[model samples]
Target: MKQQTKHSDARRPLMAADQSGQGARQDEDASKRSWGSEQLAAFEDRLRHLRLTPSQQSLASVVLDNPQQVAMSTIHALAGELGVNESTISRFTAALDLSGYAELRSVCRALANRYSGMLWRFMRADHGAEADSESGANRSQGDGKDLAGKNGTSGQRERRDILAAQDSSSIAASFARIDGVLWDEVVTRLGHAEHIAVIGLRQSQAVAAMFAYLLGLVRSQVSELSAGGARYLDALRDLGPHDCLFAIATQPCSKDTVNVAQWAKSHGVPVIALTDEVLGPLAELADQVLIAGTESDSVLSSMTAPVSMVQALANDVAAVDAAGTRAHLERQEALLKSFGAYADKDL
Candidate 1:
């Protein structure tokens, strides 16, 4: 079995933003946390357990809601946005036992990467050597024991456990990153849009088409943007303020989809993005972004989290107008029956 390397220590600090005297005027902590302990997941765990005053919690809320801003913005800019004094910001970091705002910002920067699709590079264990050794029948039930040691279960069982763990963790992480307010706003936009377009390309098309189909069952104007050549652009070109573009994009993200999303945003159309990254291109263009984790134990990325998000979004849209959705579904059911869409027999 191959050993996995711990690469957290090697992670480079994100480029620091320009600082000004107006940012913060406090001294650094004497017992500040080491940069090594500043890994994102651990930092988030600390955030969970750390007791906070009401003011600190409020400041934390602003950070939680806009991690990227905290990562990229100067302390002065952040203080201004939150309408809090620079000292209050310093106090908030102090409560977290951070050295100062600089350390806090570094953790935020790492977190932004984690919420985006890039964390797999940092989180996933090295499996390349194992992939080579385990080829064909030479691989026995020893792989799990390889990971869990000699006393552990067979390789097959261990593999199952690893995969299951990855799936569960990915799903939990996906839900954890969701901002309820953003979700509400997205659902509201979808409910009110005169036309809703779901655009996806390549691997993303499956989830996009599924979402569009589910949405169409309850709404009058929902479409999965066709890949039928230039006509896709024609469909996007027609969008306006009354319309919404619900884009489903995953890694290896489509340029066309990003362009269309940006184009719609410029045209006053609300764009809702269900994607894998927090700082992904689509997220940047989207008015509302819902993160869905794509990490997997295997080389190929998982769509489980993304699909679950879509299902939740569909249910929310249905809830927005329960009576109207019920009527529309009933009408569609009647039409399907009239057309004999389903066979009379089970066959």
Candidate 2:
């Protein structure tokens, strides 16, 4: 996942945020950059729900299934290629809410550009140009002649952009693998629990802390169990079938987290886990499992996707009982104001 662009120098992932358990966006969760094709998804949903004539269906597949070919073909050529009448092709585009074949072709062209390995090409072209420019400048400078640098920092920026794209894709892929049934089951279990204990260490500590904090705001009896002074063992002892254990662990899984999870599972305390692998140690012990990708360029792994999961869980639990949550938050706000723990924004 940490594919380096520069052969001469491997990426150090030397950023301070890597060690701080932060990212560039969403409160230092994931990379800050957005993918260009973020909103551009396949039209398979439209095809599934729409009814079409035989000729229209043929046209639909030709235009939407593989838009790259359609983008390069004229309307008449496309009609001929699909053995569909020109009128049928026009009708297909109309049904898709396009003005005509031109707009349809435009849409297809955009999709084709995105799916056609253009990102890799863009990086290669820019990187190669920068390398060539740098080489020429180096040779000239070695001969005691100075040459201006070209594309100064653009190549470096593109490298970071590619990594951001990779992180975005990983986040998307991780979310896509979620099981709807298990998600609802876990949400219900956590929302209705009597107590919730969160355990995380090393790379997973930030995620566990955030989940515990957010879950605590909407529901009491939520705690982050650390191993300091054997206190977590005391906390685990109180867990029972009525309570839930939320565990977070990734590569190089913490022994304490795993032991605590095993303890919970054996004691009949429902365990829910957020982890990086499908078959990790935490996953084995968890009653319910959620997966996220921690692959990153740095020596430190990423927790971006896990942070997103924490937000989703806390938010869903908050929504389980609207009235109770609202009252709880109101009381919490009053307590905070009374203690003057936070500065009053109105002042």
Candidate 1 Cα deviation (angstroms), residue 328: 0.5
Clashes of each: 2, 1
Q: For residues 1-347, write the lDDT of model 1, one tens digit per residue.
A: 01111222111223223334532332133214344434555665565455665556556644543366577555666676657787888887887777677778766755555543344322323432332233211111113222322224566686667667777778887877666777788888888789999998877899999999999998778988976768878888788899999888887578889988888888899888888755467876787778787755453567888888888888899989999999999999999989989876856
lDDT of 1 at 50: 58
Q: Model 2: per-residue lDDT, tens digit, 1-347?
A: 11112111112221211133332222222122222454334353454346777677556544443455465565555665668887887777778765556556566656555642334234323343343343222211112221222335874565455556656877887777777778888889888999999999977888899999999899888999986848998998889999999999976588889988998898899888888745457876677888887654322456888988889989999999889889889999999989989976899
Report the Cα lDDT for residue 13, model 2.
20
The C-alpha stretches of model 2 lying farther than 4 A from their native spots are 1-156, 344-347
RMSD of each: 12.9, 20.0
What Cα-based lDDT does every candidate model obtain?
Answer: 0.67, 0.66
The segments of candidate 1 whose C-alpha lies over 4 angstroms from its true place after superposition are 1-14, 17-127, 130-157
